[model samples]
Target: MKMLVNVILPIEPFNSMVRDGSVGEIIGRVIDDIKPESIYFSEQDGSRGAVMVVEVPDASAIPSIAEPWFLNFEAHCEFRIAMTPDDLKRANLSKLAEKWNGVHA
Candidate 1:
């Protein structure tokens, strides 16, 4: 399945890394490892942040995806399942609605 990984990097260590010119190398290592389908960098809540869409094989894969950021940048990470339009179509929501509509509560 595809997962959206949101990473929030703390100011202190992130700034220190940038000042020392290690940011690019570290980020490159992470990018190489995760091999995200898509990635975007921006600020979130006044902190350095990144959003990456990656393929995750299973729940056990979460740590491998998240630990790099945590260990390198002391970052906070959140993961959410993501689906393409075709994946959503496969869900058969109309059938679910019909089944649930018959229930009182």
Candidate 2:
């Protein structure tokens, strides 16, 4: 499955890592291990944040990807299932709609 990983890091250790010049190296190491299909970096809620899309074989793979951020940066992380355009196109939405057409929210 494809999963989206969002990581939000606090300022203290993140800023400290930047000051010490280890930020890039640390983040790079983690990125290399995960080898995500896509990654974007930006600020979130006034904190350093990243969004990564990667292929996950199973739930067990999550710890390997998230542990780096947790142990190194004390980051707040989230994982969610993701779908590509093709995946959406291939979905059986018609059948799903028929199955729930009369269902209440």
Candidate 3:
């Protein structure tokens, strides 16, 4: 599965916690702390806030894992299931749409 969690962390919190940390350190900590099956930090282009990609084996526990950054507005996540092209080609419209959207973005 693939989850695109877009967080607009308050400036103060970002400064205090994650902004200065090395990518490896932060990714490692997030993995160890949240224990998601796989999580990756993505650097946004010309954007104020950061974005993250998390892959978890199960769909549960996402709320708790995402709770910390729900400070400004709400933490927005676009969740999706991953599949090979052949699999995607055979998917229903709703599923294919999500995958297409991810690719285009």
Candidate 4:
């Protein structure tokens, strides 16, 4: 499965790392470890953040994939299954809609 890992780092440690010039080295090491399919860095909700897409063989691998960011940057991390356009096209939307479209109402 492919997962999107969203990382948001707090300003304090993040600024410190930037000032010390360790930010790139830290992020680089994790990138080397994960070898993500895609990665993007940008601001999110007024915080420094990154979004990376990587393959996860199983649930247990989440810790290995996430721990580096947490340890290095004191980051708030979130992981979610990500879908490509082809995957979305293959979904059984009609059935899902029937199942839940009006259930809340």
Candidate 5:
């Protein structure tokens, strides 16, 4: 079974994580190494916060798999879920947009 996990974390530090490129590198390494299937992060306008979604095989992996990352930020354990199509669609689009550049060779 597949799941969609969500976590909300503080913004400024998260942005700092982005500025130092640790967010990108860390998240990429986590996903590539652990192979969560899908995970994503987003920041809201006018809010000093961000949220992330991580798809895991089951809830069992949450503690060991997530603890390290959780320690790096102020977080809330938002969800453990089975993703819907709309959820997957939004994640896929947002993730692609983050990695995409308008220019094509």
Candidate 6:
């Protein structure tokens, strides 16, 4: 399955790493390990952040994906399942809606 991994890096260790010029090398190592399908770096909530679309084989793989950031940078990671248009079509949402539309708890 495709997953959106949101990473929020804290300022303390990250700033120190930037000063020592180790940030790039560390980040490169993590990125290489994760091998995301796509990645974007930006600022979020006044903190350094990265958004990555990664292909995860299973739930067990999540820790491997998130632990690197957690251990290396003390970063927060969030994972969300993502689906392509074709995947959405395969869900048959319209049929589900029809079945549930008039029924509510």
Ranking by TM-score: 6, 1, 2, 4, 5, 3
Question: Candidate 4, after superposition: displacement of residue 86 in Å?
Answer: 3.0
Q: Give per-residue CA lDDT, model 5, range 1-105, as digits (tens).
A: 454555566675778998887886766665565565555556544444334445555568677556645776655545556668876786878668778858587
lDDT-wise, the better of 1 and 3 is 1
**Candidate 2, backbone clash total:** 0
lDDT of each: 0.95, 0.95, 0.54, 0.91, 0.61, 0.96
Name model 5 segments beyond 4 Å from true: 44-59, 83-105
lDDT at residue 4 of model 2 (Cα atoms): 93
Candidate 6 local lDDT, 1-105, one digit each (tens): 999999999997999999999999999999999999999999989999999999999999999899999999999999999999999999999999999999969
lDDT of 4 by residue, 1-105 (tens): 899999998897989988999888988999999899999999999999999999999999999988998888889999999988989878978889998887874
Return whichever of 2 and 6 wins on lDDT. Answer: 6
Which residue window of length 10 is worst by lDDT in model 3? 68-77
Best by TM-score: 6
What lDDT does candidate 5 reach at residue 4?
Answer: 52
lDDT by residue (tens digit), candidate 1, 20-104: 9999999999999989999999999999999999999999999999999999999999999999999999999999999898789
Which stretches of candidate 2 lie above 4 Å from their native place?
Answer: none
Return model 4's CA RMSD, one decimal.
2.1
Over 4 Å off in model 3, which ranges? 16-28, 35-48, 71-84, 92-105
- Report the number of the highest-lDDT candidate: 6
TM-score of each: 0.95, 0.92, 0.44, 0.84, 0.51, 0.97
The lDDT-based order of candidates, best leading, equals 6, 1, 2, 4, 5, 3
1 against 2, candidate with superior TM-score:
1
